[model samples]
Target: MTAKPARDPRDYSWLPADIQAFIARTEAAYPADAVTFSIQQQRAFYDRLCADFDPPHPPGVTTEDLTLAGVPCRRYTPTAPRSGVTAIYFHGGGFVVGGLHSHDAICAELAEGAQVVLIAVDYRLAPEHTHPAAYDDCAAVVDSVPGAKVLIGDSAGGTLAAAVSATRGETAQIAGQVLIYAALGGDPSLPSYTRHAFAPMLTRADVEFYGTVRYAGGVAPVGDVTATPLAADSYEGLPPTAIFSAEADPIASDSVEYAARLAEAGVPVEMTEEPGLVHGYLRARHMSEGARASFRRITSALAALAAQAVAQ
Candidate 1:
């Protein structure tokens, strides 16, 4: 099948006014070439970027910084009683940047929205640490979280969530997965990759660069399900999934294709594309109506998944 055509610059004009303003403000603070900076600089900048758009922490929520099975994590607990469900989140930074602190606000909002406990893993990063390290860290935390759990992540973290869900399908531990604009395994030649290769925030080249650094040691096999879940032989028996894709993201096709594969595998899946939004739109939830709507959908999906786990 032919890939979707490239998006026209004019298409951005159709976005909500608040989204447009958010993008403008973001561009002014972070230039396109910012990705070329050193890893240290990138981390600092990313942390600042996340902080700049951070939504207010919901009232009646408590946060705790702790480690799960040797992996550092930050937990967000809503004031309301827990439903015995937990969401293990991996932060998006292409497996190179981002940490528990970077995604603190997002996790808090999600916890408040879903009324479930949220644990954001601060997985090991690349260049210093390699492939299996980050994957291993995330898996460790996932394994530690007992009982019903949902895997949730954005971008690189999304990849980890999918990988863990597929690799551990036999355990029946995960009830569902929520991937937000995930960088799931997809061919760079796909339509979305070509069309949004140069889109704002994340680009095709940026994705490749991050992958290179993430697997610098090359210890893990390229076909390994833990490294690339999309390359898995089968997605059968996996839990229900919700995938959110940004219409203007280079990896948009990743989510689209993944959802299709899951459906074919007899796994229930829902895929939603947010128009006029770029990669990392989760950070704009407080500012963009479109983002807020998407956030609500995500929370609703998580809530449903939690209920399903309780009923079983």
Candidate 2:
């Protein structure tokens, strides 16, 4: 085989100083070479990396782990009265690694920030549980949550949230959707995909690998809304949506296209691109200025969604 080209050192000068330090700490903890390891090893490394940046759960937020509709879940309830709305969260792990515990701190902070009840689903992972399994688990929990709700997800979880919001039947009441650096499927030849094919944190090759594992058997049908929301025939009447994309992520175009489709279909939508950020920046919310700003935007969106649900 021909020798692989030497990879250039990623430029972090454009990112905030704090973010650069955060990235350095993360790299030291979980080397990029770890990506070549087995799934189990990757999962373990990911878990540790997440733990390293986990801030203490916000005060006044209580958590309980339970099974909802046969799907394992963790619920975060703030001390204040709920706005009669729920935020169903799916953790991102490329549908292979993350679980309830992996994203516990995130859920806790979100619940506190949004001042609403948050439910984090621990759906089955891949290579063992395939496509419809994780989606099914997420759908079940979304259906089980009481009253009007908003769907929130990141990466694979973002894909699940979008799928659930788009494919749910007429009766399901989704107030809005918050997609943070979501991985909605789209044409691989998109400009962002090609431009950021080898971006730091998440690369095009990494995304392709996850997609293969997510649908190990075979790819879903072209127009299957649940499998690929971007391919949905109509984005009309879905829900108000707020999509956040990292400037340097290969899948960033997925969010851009999805937002455009939603807007074209007359759905209220807002898209924000965080500059000098990469995939998985959510963990740096406490340390990085860009990540913190993104988190604030997410909190504002969730709060607005909850208010809208209450008004309805």
Candidate 3:
């Protein structure tokens, strides 16, 4: 179970100094069991964190809240005109955390970077909303969004984004997908799972804990291939995918295996590994150099997709 090659840590040196300070303060505040903390506590912590980041305006982007099939969604539209390519993004927080405010910065940046409308879905959380609830909420938004679409999310949100895209299959009007540091299910023996089991941010135990809370009262459906998009029964016609994982994270291997499966299914897929970066880097964009670099990659990928749309 040898680890795979990943981007070097030095690449993140470009991150703002204030962001680095914010990350240090945050680490001292919240650690591995962040989900176990009360919602109010988490919200307070997040609010402060967001306060620390430089408020980059979403140039050419307008935001609005709308209801689709009774589900509420916040949409970020880039000022640029295009062929109606929109992205429905979900935030990562182990299904038990995260919301509109928690991921506001990344969503805004992605919307502006990719030059596409970004619809951030606020799916119901777990221990209250439970399994299938969050995923369904996101899928419904995908089905409801007008015109072509791209599905994107980080961590648990990434899992849900992939699940929704996979479940909708080929005919669903989706354009592509971008999953960042997602936690796809995989065999425990995988290299990253064992080698980086206790990686700084995410751990196998943390994953197990999230799953337990998410499926607490449900039928506890067996971990089907579809439930775990990486292990999906099929990936044909599901659009190209970009998966980003960090070398210092435990779940990096799962994303690798998922990309391979997609490739085998003939799906166009690109996988990037960031070295010395831990899980949840996307949310810490203000602090971690790896996080900022990853965001840049996200913007570049989305912009590339926008360019291809133009050529077509």
Candidate 4:
């Protein structure tokens, strides 16, 4: 069974032209099979997208290479350093697709909007890298980034961000996390999961397929908690969180459950469910009005958290 995508919010009529175009084009490229494609194929697909996507660079952002867990990562820094607060961004594509290049536009926008350095990791994807490989790489990068930092990612990257928070010891220093449309688990009972089962881009089967590849040889963690941050036994000690969920996305429950857990743990958290948006709407920033709103919400949350961290 597949859940139907929610209709476009009535307000999308006021969205920027580029965002609207992005929605049309991306929607045309239906069924992003993140779980089914091989790493090579996925890489090629995104590479092509990057090649075609030429987003205007923010005034002073520069890109650099850094070593995390001994794996090479790409970092984007602002020309003007704002303070100690940093955003280590992970690109989403399940546990498989997406790279620094594909995410360059959004990262640059984030850097510009939040007025903070954005370190984007080019983590290895599965089924080649598999389970903990991606997680380990992310943890290493977070640990290595100098100064107080906020972890951020959309979709699969969002899942890893939460996982890293969970696995970090008392000494690991992430100040906050921003999860956008994260996958909390493989369970299909979540309302959004059942509602958007056949969502144009991401579907129920697509998630299952990705899970199989993500855990191919590794021992599957019991239930969604540990495997899914929402499923984690406790949210205590994890940094404050900001969740951005799309009303039409199947993974909406991930953010909702995570927000509830964070609150229960007495951890500070805020959640925003964008009406009528679909999965991966961040990439449609240029075409969809919803994407721009989503981006603004993301940066605003980061700025608010960064301010709190500064005050402390």
Candidate 5:
């Protein structure tokens, strides 16, 4: 049964069959109203969803857990690590759910893919810790990493990574940043938002709900850069950026607009729109061919940035 549209009609027919299957399996394993459940209940469902799709850690990759500057973090060190490049990843959970375990497999692969030490920050969640809590925790972890750093994140984590990159500017230590299916506070009225409003996996209502809970006031702060990267005063001084967006996700336009702004401000930025994919498709890398291709591209970008070989 297709969800009755609250705005424009959504067309899932354009998605690849594998992605459709991924969505079907996801919906079957996770309730559509999971977010509406109590916070504890929501986490239970999210954990189960993640477990169902969790892949084993990449061969030869090792992980260590630590509290970086008071924030719990998991670091992945592949067999061969980049000389000085360290990638810091923040997981996406709509600013509420998700923690270290949620994105372990993805982070492990990222570490191996880029051949660098990758640290996944388990930032504090919302309706409790709230806005700056997550931001501060991520910032602390970034500061903890020595030498050249590459910031990476997905969904809400993408927003945080972009925020961190913006603050560091075109600094020597900031090599690059990567955002995946991130909702960078793009206008909710953007074409992607409308077209994919009811696309499988995530919906417009879900976006609004996250926004409301992100801050203490039950709404996104009016003009905060960290809370909303799109609200930044300028994109200048930010380092090279690689943004990967899912074609069927409502927040895809955020990547488009962000890359355009970065280029306009003289920042080297690359945006890849993954066709037939939806938000949170990272878990589908092994399940969907399209997602696997996107993951390869993501890892390639990570490798290039680590080498500091991205066209400047």
Candidate 6:
């Protein structure tokens, strides 16, 4: 008898049932061709989709919106906040849509879990403020803080977290970083891009689109470490990092490569890939077991990093 052929990992059948349900629920509220629409329309679509997944913010977390170094930010303070440490979080909307409100629950939960103050950045988006603009905003917030910081972000925000890690880690005395499915300047032609190009939530095409919008005149700056951390000549001196990636996402390889580079630079790093998950799984935390586990890892990592800061 002939042996059954190996299943194609690219097929949706390879995704766990819970993840599939998450995809269905997410896409149900978000237009499948949302990327094809006007930026304003796309933002509205994304806002509605995020609202549909709303879970209550962790109890006993107090928040306030303020401007740090002229950049809008939301600060979450836990009931039992730890002194001498703070986590700066950047929300992910491909750097065009997400803002403080979009990630309110996530920030609150993270602050409560880590028992530290967490500041969620509301950086300027693209086509209006490109590339270094957002980086500068995030960095200004980092500079505004008095001591070492915990830099954290997902997707585009993850890219910013790393950029900040390289640019401000030393001056800010950055304690650590926690990146979720970050698009750390990896090769787009890699196998993950080809295999998961059409993966749920985010596609390779979407990644390319965001890149174009992120830069000025669709041209990326040459050798700008603040724009793309991976483009930096050196990864040395970066703070300890924890990266969580989705196995089925086209950008998963970015996390892998970033971790390897960090280790090579002698920077302590930990990377975890959640099998059968896709990009933007952070919003699926309440729906998928894999996502929930990843979220827990994120919170735990933040707590550990804050502890490290306190120890020093």
Estimate the overall C-alpha local distance difference test score of candidate 2.
Answer: 0.86
Q: lDDT for every model? A: 0.84, 0.86, 0.74, 0.76, 0.88, 0.88
Residue-wise lDDT of candidate 6 within 1-312, one digit each (tens)? 999986664577778899999989988888767889999988888889878887888878888989999999999999999899889999898888979878888889889988989999999998788878899999999999887699999999999999988988788888999999998878787778887888878888888888788887897777777877778888888899999999888999999988999999999999999888889898888889989998989999999999998899
lDDT of 3 by residue, 199-308 (tens): 55567777777767777563446755435665666677777888899876778888899888889989889999976677767766655676778889988887776556
Over the stretch 45-164, how does candidate 2's per-residue lDDT look in tens digits?
888888897878988899998999999999899878466789999999888898887889989998998899999999999878988889999998888877898999999999999999
Ranking by lDDT: 6, 5, 2, 1, 4, 3
Collision count for each candidate, in order: 0, 0, 1, 12, 2, 0
**Best TM-score goes to which candidate?**
6
For all predicted structures, in order, the TM-scores are 0.93, 0.94, 0.86, 0.87, 0.94, 0.96
lDDT of 5 by residue, 289-309 (tens): 999999999999988988883
Best by lDDT: 6
Best-first order by TM-score? 6, 5, 2, 1, 4, 3
Of 4 and 6, which scores higher on TM-score?
6
lDDT of candidate 1? 0.84
Candidate 1 lDDT tens digits, 180-206: 999877878779988777777778888
RMSD of each: 3.2, 4.2, 4.8, 4.5, 3.6, 1.4
Error of 4 at 256 (Å): 0.7
